[model samples]
Structure formats: structure tokens, C-alpha cells
Target chain A: MHEEDRQLVRTLIRGDAAAFRNFFDDYFPRLFRFILRRVNGDEESARDVVQSALIRAVRKLDTYRGEASLFTWLCQVTRNELADQVAKSVRQETYMRRLVDLEDDPQARGILESIPAGGEAEPESVRQREDLAALVHAALDYLPSKYARVLELKYMEDLSVEGIAEAMGVTAIAVQSLLARARVAFRDVGETLLPSLGGNW
Target chain B: MDTQPDPRADEPPTDDLARLIRRAGRRPQPDPEMHAAVRAAVEREWSAHASHGGRRGAMVLGVAAALAALAIGLSWYSLHPGAPAGSAEVGTFVAARGPVHVAPTDGHEMVVAGSRLNAGSSIETGPAGYALLTVASVAARLGPGSLLKLNRPGHVELVRGRIYADSGSPSAPPDALVIDTAFGQVTHLGTQFQVRVDPEAMSVSVRDGKVLVSQGGGRSITIDRGQGLRVSSDGEVSRLNVAPYGANWAWVSEFSPNFPIDGRPLSAFLSWYARETGLTLVLRRPVTQADLDRPTLSGSITGLSPAQALAAVMATTQFEYDMTVPGELRIESRATRGAN
Candidate 1:
């Protein structure tokens, strides 16, 4: 997959139109899954977020400085657009306020309730993985913007430390330090929010 | 909780996990539809750029065609002003455009196509195999291996390679033309001039009037007649000279009898002036700095040809000067020459 991505990047830089087709064929499913996690399993919002990221990648094609691999840069762009979507959603207050509306419809609430809150669930082992995932998400919310962004790009986007450093315009050491701090903070939050996941680790 | 292992410790197992987490953070796979959309966008962009190239090419070709017709008409007019038909053919051959304005040292001639000169046009081949053209309205520097084309009297093109022109010769009879080098277009006026163009250094020397030097990259220089400037390949313009008018043309020819001067040390003054003018002033023998200092010189560098100017300077000064070749000049202390 890495070798294929590198080839796609080389082709794109040379202005090959077909390379983007291959890129979409190879990476779209994974991109959609990443967006799904951020959007709390809302298929529609996740799809919209992924589409918007792809569109932005098209527009900002020329500014690709090649300091980071194409995949890492694309992920950064995607994350920025996702953050913007979240900010937009927050500003509109439509999503947060709609939680009350969900209670009135059990059918709608089922999907919402299925994804547990910050805490509170049974001791089922199968649900443990999902709970841990939820705890990870909750901890991510508590991180400062800089640390969270570095952590997301490093872990979620799979960007190299060198790539993250280039994206953030900092030295590799700074990125490494931020990542270390972010990991500790995340682990602390996870231990507090979901003791089961913490004990396993 | 506090006893949790550091996730980012440099220890092997922790480091491996960190690397794995880093890998996981990369962007997910792109969707098929998204890839198609991006490719479509790129194609559209490339096609748009190609069309722009086409339109620009058409515009250039149109302008060239119109100019070529005008050139042919001018050649016909010059040849057959109601005389015999055959007389017009003598100067009617087409001159190819080249990257250079001056003829090469190996006997290549630059063609000037249908240009009108409103004032003085002086062409001389000087040091370093470059041609210096000082016309009344234009000052041009023609580099080696170039062809200069002047069309419709005012339009000049440096065909093969490089030329520097301070174009704007003078208000003409609707048909005056001059071009020194292709790098910049110049129209001459009653202007003092010096132009130095070689493959390495291309410049325009302005003696008296104004010249507008414009290159392809939108780089331009507006030079008053007494100044000299250079336009580099990257479309950057640099001012080369802004001193006295004599200082500009001093190196184009030998130090003529009519070199202007104030009372300064002869050796020191000439040495400084020669350095600026690209002239070689050789001494017959080594002399003390004292002999050169306090040797006040007063002279007029006007109206004399270069050789006459040197002779005049020699007769007046306590020192004497003579030229051995067009490139080399020798100066000796008259007191020293007589004493020796």
C-alpha cells in the first residue's frame, strides 16, 4: 500500500489525470472509515466529510510542498476540513440541540443510544472493545488543540513524525515531544473514563 | 493509573508501539468517486492552460505577420521609388531574426530590416569582440553572435540572441528605426551613447537622450542619455553607470584628444578614469606616487577624435601619452622621458 501510494503521488505531480482515479479506488474506504469515527458513526455526515476533504485536496493540489508524503498531506487537509465541519456544526447548535429530539423517536434514539455516552454500560466483553473506542474518543476531546492535532495526524492519519513536523512547521523533536505528552494525557483520560480498557492496557 | 508505562519511551517496545500508532494516523483510502472528480478537474485545468498557450501563440503570429508585411512594403518603397524595377531588389532580401544583435567574430552579419534612423548611428567593434552602436536616437549593445532587425523605423528586434537598446531615437518622418540587441527594444534620439553586449554581459550605454529598455519578463529600465544600465536574463534591470557623459564613452574608443578633465593627479586621475571607461593606460616605466600626485591636469575632451584627443592631452600635460594599438595606450612623464 505504501509503495502504491508513492507511485500515485509521483504520477499526480506529473499531472496525470488517471492517477487520482487509482488513488480514490485505493484510499476512499479507509478515509470514509476515519471520518465515520469522528462523526460518531453517522454514515451521512461521514460521507459528506470525506467528500469535502477530497474536493479540497483537488483545489489545493498545487500547494503540495512535497515536504511530507502525499498521503500525509492529504490527511492533514482532511483533518482540517473535518475540524471546520465540527466547528460549523457547533456554531449552528443544530447537532447538539437535536439530542432532545432523538429521545422522542426510539427508532432514531436506538442508533444514538447504541453508541454509548462518555461512560455507563454493561460488563459484556464484546461491548468492551466498543467502549474502549468510545473512551479513546472522549479522551481525545480533552486534549488541547495542538496536542490533539499532532496525535490525530500521527496515529489516525498515519503520518510520519517527519511528515507531522513538516505539516506543523516545527522540528521533529517538537512533534515528538507533543506526541509524548498527548499519549500520556490520552492514557490518563482513558484510565479514568473506562477503567476496563485501562486495566487491559 | 500513575504506574502506566510511558507510551513514548525510547525503550524498544514503547518505541515500536509509537511507530505503529504513527502509521495508523495516516489518511484513509480515497474513494473511487473522489479520484474521478480530481482527475476531471486536472484535465480541465490542463486543457484551459493549453488554450491559453494557443491564444498567445496566435497573437504573436498575428503581430509578426503584420510586421512582416510592413517590412516588405518598406523594402519595395526603398527600392522602386518610380525607378527601374531591378533597382529595388538590391536591398530587399529578408534578414533572419537571431539571438544576437552584433555580427560574430567569425564573420556573421546582423540584419536590420527596414529601420529608420532619426539621428546619429555609430557602429564600432571594440574590445572583447563585441559591437558598440551609438546612434543619435538609440544606444545599443550588440552581443557576439546576434542579428538585429529594425522594422518600420522604430520597431527593433534582436533576432538570434541578445541586445540592449535604449530605444526612442527621435521624432522621425514616420519611418525611423534602430535596434542594437534583441534583449530590449530601443528608439534613438540625439543621444550620447555606449553599448556593450557580449554573451556574458549585455548592456546599453546612454550618452544624452532617454531610452526605454523592456524585456520579455516585464523588466524595464528608463535611462537618461548620460547613464548606462544592464538588463539581465531573468528580467532584472541594474543601473551600470550614472557619471559624466565622457566617462560612459571613454572606453568605446581610444582616449581621443578631446578628453575633458579637471586639475587632478595625472597618473591617479587617468588610472581611475581608465578603470571606469574600460581603457588600458600603460606606463613606460614605474614612477613614484609623488610624481603622479599634485600633477594638476586641465584639458578639454571635446570635438577631437579619439587619437586627436590623446595627442591634445599629451601636449598640454607635463606628462606625455601615445597609443600603440587601438587597445593599448602608453603614458610617460615628459620630465622623466627627457631626463632619461
Candidate 2:
């Protein structure tokens, strides 16, 4: 996977137009969703931060060593950009205040601690459902692109196995196998990350 | 593989999980305009990097060229020990406020006091920013919303906004600070002057001494002390009488370079105050030259405006000051106060 990402980066640095487009199209939306969650869904601020991160990443493309997947590296860069934006702006106070409140409130702490390991049960309230959605999206963000795409094709697009295979250009059997792996990956990552949100997911 | 039961065999049905996943995916995507703008900016950066074979290569090349130049410069300096090193650095920022930025070859970086500016550098002030630099021995102040480029030691291009230049005392040899603008070129003749550029016109106002404004087609106008000249975009010229001090000159003192008062003579502080405020300094009869030359000042007057510094510094001396005549500050012995 890293070798494939390095090859794509080489093509991008060589000024291949199609490679550049694919790079932006593949990672930009995922990175945007990743940052949007952190910025309390302020879409405009998220867009600005994502744009700055992508521009910086492209400029520093030659420095990418492929030690991590390209999307993970991009997320690191986006986090730095988000941190800079937060420092430079007073507008993130509401988002920051909610995080502080979460740290202090025992009820919020209890909700986070009560989340089951498998994450199979439905959330108890409408608010928890919204938080669950955010956790699911964040989990999808952490997955490999192929896994995330296959899962999205299956669940969000409401595609049958044959439809997922057609969209992914794979066999129906392959789609089923990828779906099985994706579901487990989603559950494992969500279990690890959801608690960190402290009931604000 | 055969021993492991299918992971999906015990998995819950897809109906409920699909709803959750679909709801998560419903978050907002980038708007079309923002997507396009980001794509455009990213592609531009990618092209820049690609054209240079990536920034790493460009940086390596830049370093190599700099090293090669340094080697030659060092060899030349070795043979000529008395000669000055050839450096592009033209000045150091004496004061800066708000978001004053300096861009050399790479990109813009915020400037602070003591920031060295090279000859080819560009200085830009944010809407609330002000900066003071001594370039080529001339005190140059950039007003807010100004962009000035240092072309060489004594020449600059005023791209937009206002810049004030003080070419030291009238008796000193003129370094001839030349400023190029949209309307014409202004070269000061050992004087203090301001050049302002607006969208429709360019104006040059002189506070002391004189400056020669040369317009296109070989037309030239010499503006003396206390005069202002305006040239419209269509080349129409107008003149007006301006005062040497008052509300017009107040902004310059707001970010005036710090005056080090530690162990300095009282006369030196008064000299700085006079130049900064465009006021004449007069010592009354009882205030002897010996009194003015005494090094009695100690401590700091930092972060104080010119008027405040004047009051603070004067309160420590045996002299008092009066500004009853607008452009002149009178100093007299405290013992002789109100005797006139």
C-alpha cells in the first residue's frame, strides 16, 4: 500500500495532470470531513483549513517518505493547519467551550464510559444518534480508501453485492469479502476513537 | 481459513447498520465554488513544484548558488581586507506595529524590529500596520496599507499607499532617496517629505527643505518646505500650502523609533522630539548651552508618545517647555518660568 502511494506521489511530482486530479479528488473530501468534525461542523472554516493543508502538502510532496499512508499524512497536516487556525481566531470559542464542558460533566463522562465494546446497540437518544453518526464517519475516515469506498457503496448508496462489484470494478465475491473486512475495521476503529470524543462525537 | 467461520455469519443484518452509515455520509460536502477554488490553488502549487522539479531540488539549487557566491565573495574580501563585504541587506526595521511583512525572494514573513531587509525585498503593511526603517541612511516610514519595494540602497518603488522619507539634516550630504510612483519620480534634496498614491492621483508633501518631482515627458516641479503637489491620473497638477506640523503630521509620531535616553544629554532628546514632531526647539535666555548638554537623563521612555515623552523627560530637568506658537517648542529655566 505504501509503495502504491509512493508511486502515485512520484507521478504527482512529475506533473502528471491526471495523477494530480486523482490525488485531490481521492483525499480532499475525506480530509474535509475529518477537519469538519474537529471544527464543530463550521464548514467554511473547515474548507479554509483543508485548502491550506492540501496546498502545503503538495508543496512539500517530495518530503513524503510513505512511512504512513498518504491520507494519514494528509490528516496530520490538516490537524496542524486546524491548530494554527484555532490559535489565530477567536471564533472557535464555542467549539472549545463545549470540549471543556465535556471534560467537566459527569453525565457526559458516563455516556462515554457506557459505550459497549462492540458498538452494536442503538444509541438511547436523538443526540446520541447524531453523535453516533459522527463516530461512524470518523471511523470511515480512518479506513483505507478501498475499504471506505466499498462500505459507502454498500450501505450509503444502498447497492446490492453486484452493484458494489460494478462500482468498484471487482467481482461480487470480492465485494462481499471487502464488506466483511470493512465492517470489522469500522467497529474496531470506532470502539477505539469514540471514547476519546467524551460523548461529543 | 477453513477453521475460521465466516466473519459475516454472526454479523447483524445490514438494515440497521446501513441506516447509520448512510446518516453519517450525509454530512455536508464542499460547495462547488470552494471546491473549484481549492482545486485551482492546489493545481497551481503542484505546477510550481513540478516546474522546479519539486521544492527540494529548487532549495538545493538555491543553496548551492548561495554557497558559490559566498566563496567568491570571501576570496575577494581576503585580497582586499579594507573593502566592505558585498551584502544585499539595505536596512534594519527600527519599529513595526501590526502585521508588517517583508517578502524577499520566497514569500511573505512578518517583520519585527531589527529585521534586516535586502535590496530586492518588498515591504507591505496591513491596514492597521505601520513600520519604520532606516534605508541607505534615510529614515523611511511606511503608513498603513502601503507597499514599498527596495530596488537598491537609495532607490525604491512606491507601489501604493503612503511613505514618508527623511533625508537627515539639511547640512548633511544628500543621499538622494529616489521614489518611483505611477505619476512621476520624486527625489528628495536633503529634506523630509511624504508621497501618497491613491487610485486617482499621487501627492507629494514636503515638511522641510525641498524635493524635485519629475513627471513624465521631462516635466519637473520643485516643491519647497511647507508645500504639497498633487498630480492626477490625467497629468493635471495642483499645489497647496501645507503646515510643517499639526494633525497632518500626527500619525508619523505614533510609531516613532524609540529614543534611547539612558545617560544621553537633554539636548539630544529635544532634538529627536523636534524632528519627530516637525517643531522648532528654542532655548530661552536663562537656559544655557551647558544646561542642555548635561547628561542627566536616566531610565527609559519606551512606549510613550512624543508628547508624553516630552512631558516625562522635561519634568526631570530644570527646564520647562511651552508650545503656545503651534510649530515651536520653547524651553526655559524653571526659575524663569512666567517671567516673560
Candidate 3:
């Protein structure tokens, strides 16, 4: 670590609210955007993961050898949190898989089809769904955080133009213009990033 | 949905990503409350890190204070050699009535009130004897003729008698304090409750919070504050609704610890009184809870029972308390109490 970076780390250890607020304000938007994509746009889970990651990072500061940037360290911590979340959700995920498999039964399918899981009988299909969710998440990850966030809030979270404007502290008109540009950029990048899970788009 | 047309409406040239973006829409902004909550949590961590330099070095205020007290006592250990180690040094005991007998479960000789007992110790009270003890932060009173086995740090077993316990946190799922009984096991979730064991059955009562009674096999039920239940040796269960306060708690008064009220707020004293008596705290009009928040008394009401303590503490302030309901305590202004 550079001497300046070390000092910054020291300031973080001081545990002052103002210093923390400054750090949180600086990194939260970027972290939130990153997590939102990975969790398939589930806002609550994304927020939980982000909070856990940052808290863990703050506690483990002594291990910071400056081998990687602080942001990279945080991402590494987030990856671990994601793995834990994945493990915890195994039961629910299995149930979801069962629902998907039973989709062929009409009486049962009528009840289970709305479960929104990957195709049954094909383990590959399950992997594809998981991978596609990850691919889209990574694609969003590669975009400018703001553009990716707007697209996610719109499509993934189903927020309105006015709602997005209020969140971004911009006018509805500005949001639309950003959305138009973001869509073009996202398509440009997503084409290569997307796994070939029948890339109809 | 976008109300305005795409800025590049005329140039319809590119890829599927634009469609995807338009479809993916706005990412949900993190809730503002979550932002504050996480920031507060992280700030606590940062402060701890800054204070101690390492996680192992950090101890919360209560634990640190307790350890300091312990270190001071251990310093004098050299003067007193051959003292038996306390297997589960659950807090000290205060004799409330006739002599309280305490000895290791295997020992025949019983010691006096000042004597310390270990986890495997057996505590017995004579016909008129009463004893008060604290295990961790939990407060418990052993009624007259009661016998309890100090099994260990996390558990106390009722051999044959009644025991009143108040977890004292005023919250549910309190620290672990398991009360093992013949019919089953009884535990509390931060409650003021009582458990009695007889050869034929076990009875559990709640005054303020809750108690969990597990019977033989897998049967268990939660008895909330102001409720009571009985489990027969034959595995039958019956529930009863009981007053939160009154004579049922009178025996506990004999074992009430000397509460230090000097320089404490009236509210603190009142809360102690309510918990000890198992009544709801209801402050009368004109004597709001705020009135009790300020320091009122500078003298200790030491040695006074919970009821007597309340009287002494209330006399100084303008508030007077009475039981409007068996379970509810109404502490109104002196004027209001007098009027009714």
C-alpha cells in the first residue's frame, strides 16, 4: 500500500460517523449497482449483501496489505457473501426446480408454471438460467454504473420514469434521454457478454 | 415505461442491447433507511476497530467492567489458599429469611449466606428459609422449603420446590437460563416467571414475559406473561390466566435484594418495582413517565422489600402507584391517586 492509501485506511479505522458517511456516500451507488445485477435485481437481497460485505470489510481491515485496491477487496468480500447466500437458498432453489419440473402436469403445472424456474429434465437448462442471470449481471456490471442502474431500476425492478427521475435527482425528461442512450450502449455491450442461451435479442 | 421517444429515433441502426436496456429498466435505488442502518452498523465497527486496534482487544463496556471487578477479587486469592474452585460460579446469593444452607451436591455440611457455591452445589432452605441468587444478569428467588441444584452455568434444576425467576432484560429470547424439572424443562424469554416442581406435577407461571415448558417427548407450549400452566406426571397439560401481581409474589419479597436507589431516577426504581412485583407500569396523568426520568432520590432504600421500596421512592416524588388491575400498576400523580 502507498503511504497515502495507508493513511486513508487509518482514517477509516478512526470510526467517526462523518468519515464513514463520506465513505458510504462515495461507494454505495457503485456497490449497490454491482449487487443488484448479481442477485437478479432483487433489491432487498442486494441491499443485504452490500451491507454485509461492507461491514465485513471494515472488521477485517488489519488484513489489508494493499495487495489490491480497496474496491477490489470489497468485491472479493461480496463474492464470498454471494456464495453464502447461494448456499442458504439451496432448499428454496430446489423447490423452485421441482416446480419447474412439474410444469408438464396440467393440474400441477397450472399451480407450478407461475413459479418462473428454468426448464425441467435438462440440468443444462438449470445451469443456463443461473449462468444467464450471472451473464446479464456481469453485462450490467461492465456498463457505466449510472446507465446500468437506470436500466436495472427500470426493467429489473419495474420502476417508472418519474420514480427513476426522483431517485436519480433528475427530471423525468432527462431520465428518458438517459434511458434511450443506456439502451443503445447496453445492447452494444451485451451482445458479446451474453451467454448463448438462445440470444433472441 | 418511457413517456418520451428515443433520442436516436431517426437512426434505427444498432443491436439488441438497446431493446434489452429499455426492457431491463431502472435499477431500484437502495432504500434510504437501509442506507442509514448500514452506515450506523459500519460506524460501530469502525469505532471498535479504532479503539482497540484488534478485534480480540475489544470488549463491550459491561464485560470490561465485570472483568475489572473479577481481577481485583483474584488479586487477594493468595491470602486464602485451599478454596474449592467454583465449577459454575453463577453469581452470589443473598439470604432473605432464616439461614440458607448451601453445599456441594455431594457434601453433607451446609454453609451460611456468605459462602459461595459451585455448579454442582445443592441449595436448600429450611421451613422458613428463603434465598435470593443471581446467575448472570438473571434474578431468581427460591421460596421457603425450596431445593435447587446449581447444575451449571447455563442451567438450574428444581429438585422439589418453587423458584421465581426474572430474566430482567424486559425482552424476549433472553440470555440462556434453562430450568430443568421432573416433567420436562422450563426456559424463559426474558420474563418474570415461576416454576414449581412436586412429585406429581410441575406448574409454571408467568408474571410479565413468557415461559416455554417442554414435556416428556416433544410436546411444548409457550406460556406468555400473565399466564400459567400445569403439566401432570401423566403428560396432561392445562393453561390458566393469572393476575400479573399480588400475594402470589409475596414470598418473593422476602428474598428481594437490597435495591440501591440512591441518585437513581424514579423511573428506574419504578421499573424495578414492577418487575419484582410482576405488574405493568402505568403512570397516572400529570405524572408522565418524563417526571420519573429525572433523578429524584439521593438516598438508598436498601433492605426494603420491593413494595416497601416503591413506597419510599414514591413518597419523595409527586407520583403514587396502585394496582388498577391485578396485573397492571397505575402510577398517577399524588393528586390523582388521592382522588381515586
Interface RMSD (Å), each candidate?
Answer: 15.9, 16.5, 17.3
lDDT of 2 by residue, B38-134 (tens): 7667766776677434322100000011112111110000010111235477676665554344544232133345656667666765444567787
TM-scores for the candidates: 0.25, 0.49, 0.44
Best by lDDT: 2
Candidate 3 docking band? incorrect
Residue-wise C-alpha lDDT for candidate 1, range B49-105, written one tens digit per residue: 322221211000000111222111111000101222222111111122111112111
Pairs of residues clashing in candidate 2? none
Give the number of the best model, judged by TM-score.
Answer: 2
lDDT of 3 by residue, A1-201 (tens): 555545557766754333344566446655776787676556666777888888787888777777765656677888788677668777348535654655656886575445555548355665556555555655676565568767766666656777775345344666777787777777766777864634567
Off by over 4 Å in 1: A1-7, A65-69, A89-91, A97-104, A108-127, A131-201, B1-340
Model 3 chain A lDDT-worst window of ten: A14-23
What value of lDDT does candidate 1 attain over all alpha carbons? 0.46
Order of models, best TM-score first: 2, 3, 1
Expressed as tens digits, the lDDT of each residue in A86-173 for candidate 1 is: 7885633654554455567889767656765454553363366554455454455444445656777776666777777545534456
Per-prediction TM-score, chain B alone: 0.34, 0.70, 0.67
Model 2 root mean square deviation, Cα atoms: 21.4
Ranking of predictions according to DockQ: 2, 3, 1
lDDT agreement of model 2 with the native: 0.71
List-wise, what DockQ does each model earn?
0.05, 0.17, 0.14
Report residue B48 deviation for candidate 1 (angstroms): 7.7
Q: DockQ for the candidate 3 complex?
A: 0.14
